[model samples]
Target: MTASYGSAEYQGYLRNDAVTIAEVLRLDGYRTLMSGKWHVGGSYKPRESDLWTPGDLAHPTPRQRGFDKFFGTLDGSGSFFFPHYIGEDDCQIAVETDDFYMTDAITDKAVDMIEESVADEKPFFLYLAYTAPHWPLHAKEEDIAKYQGMYRNGWDTLRTSRHEEMLGKNILEGNWEISPRDPTVHSWADEKNRDWEDSRMATYAAMVDCMDQGIGRVMAKLKQLGVDKDTLILFLSDNGGCAEFLAEEGWVESYPDISPEGKKIVQGNIPNLAPGSGKTFQSYEAPWSNVSNAPFRMHKSWVHEGGISTPLIAHWPNGIAQSAIVHTARHVSDIMPTILDVSGASYPKDFDGVGIQNLDGESMFGVFLNGHGEREQPIFWEHEGNCAMREGNWKLVREFGRDWELYNMAFDRTELHNLRDKDQNRAERMIKEYDAWAKKTGVVDWAVICAHPAMDWVKPAKPEI
Candidate 1:
């Protein structure tokens, strides 16, 4: 959804014509508040004004995207400590304290927004996007200390262990094999600088742990306000683990080597430099990311299972059935329709005299209650040159500039086996469907974008997928 849809021009900014869920909810008398990672639209620096407010009220801002209140950054990533581009409604907010952590700050603001909404006696829709566990690998020392030495065994063994655990818990069927270690990743035994690699993954875990702690705080706040059971809380990750290396060519040149807090930002795939320091902008890289998306091939950006698959958690004691796990495939787009269905909100046929697009997703409230359901349309994905389509038990996928590969998702969800050669006609049929969909959606070919000069620095085999 964040990608360049329809055309390359649609890539970065959230188009003005879009009608967001929050907008519809506002019509139904709900207050919408968002805190954290507002990458959908807007500029961090307002040219004409020096006001420090919640969000920019003007063009291409989250406030324009139906969020009445916004507190976050405009970009995908940044220093988690003293993030340079934080915003409050209509203006930029300067981080003045040395102890500022982005995850904690986002949560704190969300809690305050919730309290204010309660005091105002208004129902609220809060989009609290925690930019935790993302790149730049920044985590508190105490959080980093908890996972010290935990990843010493390396990604190869860790992937296997995680797969085993998933199998034991019936989270995955026994028919699948843990896909082999990512081709670009070295075997743990063959890896030199083992201690440093271990530290990198430890820091990544620490970021996730710290995020969990913050989530606990938010949940505690909800409970304290007596809204725990009444409020429906849904949590999800946008994509699978990221394998992109930041030391690629032109990256350091593009981003500065100093943070807003005056700390020297370390850049590169340095072996000895420990991550989780506020001064580093390093990624955990492919090997560990491979472990994070265990049993699935590839990482974020690719059209692979590991790239797009995410665990969705929904908690509503008064509404949803408890302890139910739905294995049915769902897309992120389904979130809007589900919320609208629950709230009895209507998607406008026309807004401001222009026809609005119909929601792409179906209401998933049934899945919450019945623990199983089916989507009417086949799932489709395209990023870079990678593309995939899933329909029932069959999936057809291909890497950019590569031949199509087919798999029976029911039997080979790990994508370890290719059944394309065995069923030529089925593959051809699905390819035809994908082609029609692409044409209708005005999808720009990857060949067009990949050749652009801006993509010159992207390394081919990293986990950036």
Candidate 2:
């Protein structure tokens, strides 16, 4: 499941035995609904009959997992204009109009569900997972026009400006330095095809801007329903900005070859063809991605701060009495426990004769209420063999097959200096701790996994960590 792409077998989908937060809430008399991306399920293609069927245990749909109603694409990334694998509950659906946009449709469905839940007079839990700013770089013409020349200054200036803004807002510690620009990237002044580069980033910004508009609509709906003050809305990204290019062979195969209106799809990062159109499929590659993850080294798929760090914005006018910035480190695993704590719902040890795995995360509800909380254990991460561990202010991290590097996060959260040689004992202890945690969590070696016959699709070339 940790692999980049899902398989056809049971390994591709979320396990049926596992319990979801939605299931816990539904059991406690809350209506659960979800919209947008649901990539944890099986590999689904609208034309394929041989793939996982409805109600199949090996690749269960969102409705089967715990949601009372579900509407979203099963696959990870696709065209915003015409998604490849959209579904309603357990049934596959098609884009009925040429003007259809994925983000707007998702927001509309979420609003409808909220209104229906209010009509029924039942408390509802809605999981609005937007897939904007992911890939294909598709956006509406109006949205694209808003940011057409905004990024002409290039990533260099953008990164520096953004870093300074973060410092001004106190989002980052004062002592933590801004990381150096990625060595792979060249100076903006020396780059050719400046207009094309600007368009790529502009399209990306447009996608994000459109997503923000959708969120605003959702907030308006909540206010209309008179539940805006009581509802707890949590917003967070799954990862940092992505640097992956879409020029690989077979990349276009995953998307539609033609538009719904019978236009040929222009796929890949085609410099000549400007992005943000329904027919064009492109990504805002590494240069702009570097700016997106500004002041932080690396991008998504790595365990570095740039890859893993994301702001968790908790908005609850009724629950969170006062506004205050909390710098406590937390993981996605803590979300379930935090919801349980806030809602007064008990996590069942045994659900319908199946024993559930014990939760690894502690509740962050205390942090929400008191603006501070202490973690009982150190946080650990291992993705594609890029490993890291954080114990209070100290952090140990390394790329795949590289020696461990140590940093004191309190002073150097940007990881500018490696203190591995200065503090060998602490480094050794944390390495051992990470190893123990990985072993207990059943984390397989990334290299070993890549060598397996089933993973032949994975390119031999290692991605930059």
Candidate 3:
């Protein structure tokens, strides 16, 4: 009915939470399938982004969790080709197909699972998280070819254009101001290394476009299986477009990984050295990443809106409300319970002696029954330097330990107006609420988390704050 998922540490919780979801769903005899990246444990290599085999399956892997099937990569970064991803019992396909991209691979697996379920006449749950357009951005030759010079206009133009498109599509509200291009990403025309800059964004867009095609493939399969109408598909990014290329050179022509044990590993170096070939070594770089997170400030790690915000599209012909509606109040944690509600699963109090955490989410499944109703639950998020609490339209957010900023989300979606000083009493109340939530949720304050852990790759770079 429902599922838990996320990046690294978050995924760890998701795995544990999914177990909670599955045991409950089993009471109703429903099937759950997970197909995507599961980056939750210690990386197998010295580097964080490396993708390879015999990954450290030390902790609870997807197999141990509630998922009957799992398909995904271990580390975050990888060459698109011959990625370190592997499928679970059913997911581990024995394909010797040559030159198959990871995005296509996962989609194919999902389609296979769906077809299998249809044959078995089983009502199923599927988590299809595309690892594309993330890092090590690589795409099919034709996909990369489609955007030859599409990004020559630079991020400023691209971000503005995409923002306009989102608004035109009614995907964005009338009040939000498109955030400016990130200062870190230089304009292509002004960039000294024009070839590299041009290739970077072209690669990023190609990755996204390629994934879209892969989604089309999955949809086609669903239609063929005649489950297109009955199935529920939730499409969204895990977080806002990431901008984590800490090193100036995001691409190395070759991705080099050396294990803590000193074993040198290159991500599908063969057949990938060629520019157009989708391989694991390359990343889309920063300029286009700026566009991927349109009209939002900051990237993945920051607690800012841009870092945490994502466009969520819920579609199910049988279950979804017909009217196109936007539910701005939902958070990632809410997804699990919502799915559970649809499949009619109960949340078990205890499973295998491991007591499950209470559901931090409420089911908006009622939305399908009674239009998109108001969320009775408040939205809360904390990760890295970002911390936010949403009670109705009022939101309180702070970047790291900096002073809290207040915004009336209903009026100022971009959060350009800071009402902290203007509304001191409200700000104080919100801060107190956030402090309580942070303590309750095990949020490791970035100031403390990074300091003792040597958070960055470059060690001992202490936080000035």
User: What are the Cα lDDT values of the candidates?
Assistant: 0.80, 0.82, 0.65
The residue pairs found clashing in candidate 1 are 53-88, 53-89, 54-88, 54-89, 55-88, 55-89, 55-90, 56-90, 244-464, 302-465
Q: Comparing candidate 1 with candidate 3, which one achieves the higher TM-score?
A: 1
lDDT of 1 by residue, 214-304 (tens): 8898899889988888888889998999888776344443455676656677776688888887777788888888998999999998888
Error of 1 at 68 (Å): 1.4
Report the poorest 10 consecutive residues by lDDT, candidate 3: 1-10
Q: After the best TM-score superposition of candidate 3, give how far the Cα of residue 196 lies from its true spot, in angstroms.
A: 3.1
Winning model by TM-score: 2
Residue 249 in candidate 1 has what lDDT?
A: 46
Off by over 4 Å in 1: 1-11, 42-59, 453-465
How does each model score on TM-score? 0.93, 0.95, 0.84
lDDT of candidate 1 vs native? Answer: 0.80
Residue pairs whose backbone atoms clash in candidate 2: none
Model 2 clash number = 0
Stretches of candidate 2 exceeding 4 Å from the true structure: 1-10, 44-54, 248-252, 458-465
Q: Best candidate, lDDT-wise?
A: 2
Candidate 3 TM-score versus the reference: 0.84
Q: lDDT for model 2, on a 0 to 1 scale?
A: 0.82
